[model samples]
Target: MIHFNQVSVVYADARTPALDGVDLTVPEGELCLLVGPSGAGKSTLLGAVSGLVPHFTGGTLHGTVTVDGRDTRTHRPRELADLVGTVGQDPLAHFVTDTVEDELAYGMESLGIAPDTMRRRVEETLDLLGLADLRHRPLSTLSGGQQQRVAIGSVLTPHPKVLVLDEPTSALDPAAAEEVLSVLQRLVHDLGTTVLLAEHRLERVVQYADTVVLLPGRGRPPVIGSPAEVMAVSPVHPPVVGLGRAAGWSPLPLSVRDARRRASELRARLVGEPPASRAAEAAEPVAEPVATVTSLGVLRGTVPALDGVTLGLSRGEVVALMGRNGAGKSTLLRTLVGLHKPTSGRVTVGGVVPHRTPATELTRRVGLVPQDPRDLLYATTVRGECANADVDAGAAPGTCRDLVLRLLPGIDDDVHPRDLSEGQRLVLALAVVLTARPPLLLLDEPTRGLDYAAKARLVTVVRELAEQGHTTVLATHDVELAAELADRVVILADGEVVADGPTADVVTSSPAFAPQVAKVLHPQPWLTVHQVERALGAAS
Candidate 1:
């Protein structure tokens, strides 16, 4: 259904081509997953399908890209609207209406579909995506995951033959991600729709893809094959695949269940061995709490978003806030950063109430990296953004730029902020926040768009900060990341804290939040692939 022949895209000012000499094809009624490292041109390849590459992005296309036998170079996105539906990473950017129902129907209305058919498709999409109960709610009030589902449903309502999605499940929780993937499976099997998607969280969607498209970095050619064939050599992969490779398993397993079936000897080897503990556990305790939430209760439009939640963070502590969608994780972060005022209780940072502090004073006490990094970025170039951050934080001129270089090496400073990849943009936002050197740092979803290599750099940065007597709290759904970086885990459900303890105690006990390594090596107390490898090495 989609074909690219000798495709290469070069932007106006870029010296290197985003995509270089790529030839690929996606058959009808199949789901193709595009996998690659950050800045490897996965999004550029996806844009080529709907004619957004050269038409809207103002780039030059060397080769032809066709969808349903129609050349994209000759046709604009509006001209091929009937054949393709595209949903980007940011859902709020795609919405034209206030409520969920209206947003879903806006696309059909633009296409001038028959009223009867549009109404039927709207209801069908709402049901299929599990948005029936939220049909009347405003889009801005929903959680990040719910907004993602609504964005996808809005496109699916048009009933196009080809669907293109970028990081579709990055914002969703585990169960909600499964629901979205299952819907894609049904579309491919029952309805014969062609689905092309790019995702960073490969563990969630790798098992469900019909075929995998691997884009190696450094301007290499693309590799297309089955999931197993591609994952065997793919640099970016989930923990299960890494475990399979470490143990020399043939035909690397894609899912935790398959790995568990082949893990008998591996489990026995790690029977009585305990994993290495984090440095946070052995460090000296703080004299007093850096931030404290006492009976904190926040209300969002008559709904209790945070209910009587009491927590404390000490100096040099790293805590991970985890929960399902709309379980008050983001709400709690916003409360700490003074974005949301508590309705019934109080929150104090350094013994001063966050909600009552002035904006300038609050910047010195706390900093928050929100889920959408674009909200904090407005400068045209990367260098300008870093300079603005330094001025805003009252830091040295080159402080922010130095942090940016450390977080993302080799990124062009003269490039426009809008032209950077999602991961690079996130790192830039983080560098802006770090300029203030706030005592308390909070990240809503830190690793949403980061690849493994970038994530390792962030891990090192956060760990160094913790050692330097900074308090950190990050809310995330990436279990492997939590397993690696978090000293403690705090879980919330329905606006209340359900569990809070050491990382090993909380994540290993819960199935939903456990990483793949823990799932495969059950009852062994292993949390990460690195830990398992260490245990094996020690035993040998």
Candidate 2:
């Protein structure tokens, strides 16, 4: 469906091509998973297919790149609109209509499709993507995952033959992501539509991919082939892939089922040295009160957003704040950070009232990374952004340079923070806040746009910070991320804490928010795949 032959793309100001003499062909109806570290140019490659690179983005192009045998350079995005449909990271940013059903029909109306036909397509899409129940809901009322699905449905209603998605599930919960991926699968297997996606959550899609395209770092060659073939040798492997590598298994397994099947046979075939004994079942860390809210309550307009809710974060702990959208999670975080002063009850951070302290003083001890990376970044260069953030940290000039380099080694110092990819900018903004070494850290959807490696980096960074006695709080819809990284899992429902306990105790109790692994391994207290791998046979 798409072919690139010695295709190199260079922005007018760029010193080098974003894609370097790349050569590859994607067969019709193939679901190709594009995987790589940040700034590996996944967006650049996808833009090439949709005529956004050299055409919309104003870049110099060389060699041949074609979509459905039509030259990309000649066919701009509008020209290729009917040929391909794209869904990006921020679905709300792209939405033009107010309601779900209308949003789905927007694309069809643009293509001059008849009203009757458009209605039928919208109905089919509603059922296919499981949005029939939500057909009348306002787009603003939907959750992050539901909004992203609406974005996909909006594009699919036009019945485009080629679908291009860039990090479609980065902002959704695991269940939401599964819905989007299932839609993509049906589009390919049932409808014979070709699918090309750039995503960070490999666990959701890698096992089913017909082709995998791994872009080499900025200056290297692109590796493209079957899932097992490319992943077997890739230096940057997913955790499960890493497990296969450590286990010395041939024909690397991408999913746990495959791993289990192979491990059972390998147990008999080999008497290799047992891997180092895994960590013992860790005792639950004592929860200390870092920031406590006693009898806290707040009202939005007339409705109470939070009511008599008592919440606390402990020193040296990762607490995952789980809830439905508009369930008061954001309100609680904002209130804690002094953005929204609580109407009642005492809120304390490090035993000091955040509301009573000066804003500058509060920021010094507390770091809050917001949901939209755009909100935090307002500087011309990545370095400049970090420098501005540093003025509060009382650090010498250029202090953020080393700090950013430490946390985000993949980011170049010169690029504008806004110009980087969604995931890149997110991680960069996060690195800026960490420069302060705040005693208490607050993050909202920290892993939204980050890739697998980036997610792993954030997990490690948070773990290290907690071990150093800094309190960490994360507001996320990603249950899997919560299960893996959180020491204490707190579920928020309608603005009050509905459930609270150790990660194993809370997440393992609810199927709605539990990690997929919990379904297979019952009676397992471990919340992470890494923990499971390290403690293999310890339970047996």
Candidate 3:
């Protein structure tokens, strides 16, 4: 249903094209997955399908792109509204209305659909995406994950023949991601809708794809094949695929069920060898408490975001706050950073109350890299942003820039912040916060836009910080990251703590939070590909 004819896109004053020599066709009723590292033109290609690339982005389109017999060059996004629906990387930018129900109906209203038909689709989309309870909530008041669902539901309500989504499940929790993917699966299977999506979180959607498109950046052409075929050669892949390669399995597995079927022999090989103790690596004398929360409670409007949450963060511990979407993870992070005033109870960082501390005083005790990295960035260029961070934190010159280099090397100093890829922007924001050198650092969904390589670098950086006696608390849905980086995993639900313990104990005991490695080699205590590889190496 979608065809790209020798497509190459180049922006003004660019030395290379964002996409080059891409020629492919996506059949109708199929879910096509786009995979690659950051800056791989995945977003550019998705934008081209909805005519937002050359049309809205002000780029030169060298070749033709057709969707459902309508050429993108000839038909703008508005012209193809009935045939195509698109949700970009940033969910906040996609909303046109203030409320959830209104936003869902806005697209159909624009298309001049009858009121009755629009209402029916709105209800169906809300139910399909598990947004029925949030139907009347204000867009700004909802959590990041909730806003993402509303953004998706808005597009789905139009009943477009084609859906173009960039990082559709990036903001969603595991179960919520599954629900969104299942909705797309149903659309492709039952309704014959074409789905072309680009997501950095391959573990969530790689198993659902009917076809895979790999876009190697730097003007390289795209490679198209089946999911297994592409993942076999793709540099970026999910943990399950990484495990398959490590185990030398024929026909790499894309899902947990498939991986488990072939894991018996490997499991026997490492029968007695326990997985590496990630928590033990950080073993030390119980350090002083860096932050303490005493029966914290926060209310957003009338909704209880956090309720009676008591927690303690040590000076050198890396803790991961995890749970379902709207489980008060972000709210707790905000409370620690002093962004939200507790409705009841108290929060303290380094002996000072966070909510009551001055903004300048709070920076020394704690820093937060929020879900949207752009909130911490204001300067036009990367260099300027770093310089501004240095001044704001009262740090020496080049402090922030050096941290950025450590996190994401080879980034151009002159590149505009707006021009940076989503992953780059997120890394830059992290560097900006790290410049403060706070005793406690909080990261909300740190791996939202990061590929595996970037995420690995992040893991290393966070580990280094923990070694230096800094406390790190990351509220995330990326279970793999928690397994690899978190010394302890704290699960929250309904504004309260549900589970808290060592990474292995909390994750392995819970099926929903287990990583692919843990799931594949179940009844065994393994959480990551590195852990399994280490066990195999020792046995040999």
Work out the TM-score per prediction: 0.97, 0.87, 0.98
How far off is model 1, as Cα RMSD? 1.6
Error of 1 at 448 (Å): 1.1
lDDT of 1 by residue, 157-199 (tens): 9889999999998888787888889999999999999999999
For each candidate in the order shown, give its overall lDDT on alpha carbons: 0.90, 0.77, 0.91
Tell me the number of clashing residue pairs for each predicted model.
0, 0, 0
In terms of lDDT, the best-performing candidate is 3
Point out the worst 10-residue segment of candidate 2 by lDDT. 273-282
lDDT winner between 1 and 3, please give it: 3
Model 2 misplaced stretches (Cα beyond 4 Å): 12-16, 130-143, 263-288, 294-309, 323-328, 340-347, 350-358, 477-480, 493-496, 509-540
Output the better candidate (2/3) by lDDT: 3
Q: Tens digits of per-residue lDDT for model 3 on 237-288?
A: 9999999998999899999999999999999998899987965666551569
Give candidates' CA RMSD values in order.
Answer: 1.6, 3.9, 1.2
Model 2, range 147-258, lDDT digits (tens) per residue? Answer: 8888988999998889989887776665666777888888899988999898777767787789999986676889999999999877656556765765577888888677
* TM-score of candidate 3 relative to the true fold: 0.98
* Candidate 2 local lDDT, residue 303: 58
